[model samples]
Target: MTDNLPLAGRGCVVTGGSRGIGAAIVRLALAQGADVVFGYHSDEKRASTLVDELRAAHPDRQCSALQADVADGGEAERFATEALDRLGRLDVLVNNAGITRDALFARMRPEQWHEVIGTNLDSMYTVTRPLLMPLVKQRGGAVINITSSTGLHGVPGQTAYAAAKAGVIGFTKSLAKEIGARGVTVNAVAPGLIETDMTAAIPEDKAEFLKSLIPSHAFGSPDDVAHLVCYLASEKARYITGQVIEISGGLVL
Candidate 1:
């Protein structure tokens, strides 16, 4: 309601916002008073449900979702264009869409490698390239890429995932330098062992093993990552860019 709120009146677009960390970012963005358009790859039911809930809570805010697979360049472009159409302009772009294909390097199939790379790394170019000019023209905004702890420290069976996430980090740093002069802050958030469906799939024994690796001896929640993203998207973080801030509960330290 008040302009003093960090992201009041701003517009945001979040990819893969139908569930998990993506969903948390969407909710936090709306709570910060930003009009948001989010994309979902397949789960139309979940996407529709989230949109409905947000709309009900903020009747006057623009909260919408589109079914899109941002791994495809054409779909990414269309999703960005539609987001601009719905919100009029963009102030924050959260590249939170990614996938994991965990397998030992020796056992990994080409499709597994391709899927992870296309979704996690290539989607960065596809989703952000179309919107880059407009964001630069706007002269102030934030671009937050969701990376991972595996990217920071290599994981044994996650060769493809780690590589893709590492690429995201590299892309974020390079883009930040290019866009910083234009007032668009680009950064990456790498989460560790977050309690999402992705982590839920880990066998209980493996999950406990990971928990032991974290200094906090626990898995982080989606909100934990969302809170950091909210700060990075705000004016408070204007001076912060080209950095990878990890929310790993001391896992990487």
Candidate 2:
């Protein structure tokens, strides 16, 4: 591995890495010379394909997958343990797992709110809680949480999603302060309307309208978010923490 690959000799764990932005993070982390272990909820085939593809490219490094609903504390514990065992040590943790159940508050069911919160916000605690000691014991690491623009500026129909993502920001900042002395860094990346399976749900007209709001007049790709995450996880970003950096092509600006 070369010096340019900033994450050389590191071990990374990403949740919900079967597809979309999560998948991109996994690919980039591996490319940067990190042994990676990722969790996926259901998509076994997609997860297997990604593992195979990444393993083929970096045969010397470890690439592993664990099937677990990270929103559940028990499952998250199991996932973290297995990943640590496989990678030997943890250097970075990316909380990229999330789900959106969009609706107007008046019509939003309790299940929708709970589900979104559980998967997006609560999963942060579930997954990260189990891994905190490992990171702190290591004496240094990076924690990157994948938030959304809707969290920074609320959207009309994304009450649950907005709330969950916003919670992620709070979690990131608070955790950063709590762990800073241990040489660990915690930060958030708020991506705006990235071109992913998640955004594929937006109606064509609505998607176009959203793009018009961005100065770039275009949607971002998963790689856009991945690049930022890789930087945050590297030694170069050691001085940066408890900050929310948006990768939205000036959408919020």
Q: Show the colliding residue pairs in model 2.
A: none
TM-score of decoy 1: 0.98
- lDDT by residue (tens digit), candidate 1, 1-253: 5577788999999999989999999998898888999999988999999999999998878999998788899988999998989999899999999888788899999999999999999999999998999899989999999999999998999999999999999999999999899999999999998998889889999888888888889999999999999999999999999999989999853
- For model 2, how does the per-residue alpha-carbon lDDT over 42-135 read when each residue is reduced to its tens digit? 9999999999999999898899899999878899999988898988999999999998888899999999999999999999999999889999
Model 2 CA deviation exceeding 4 Å by range: 2-4
Candidate 2: Cα lDDT at 100: 85
At residue 229, candidate 2 shows an lDDT of 98
Alpha-carbon lDDT, every model:
0.93, 0.93
Error of 1 at 212 (Å): 0.6
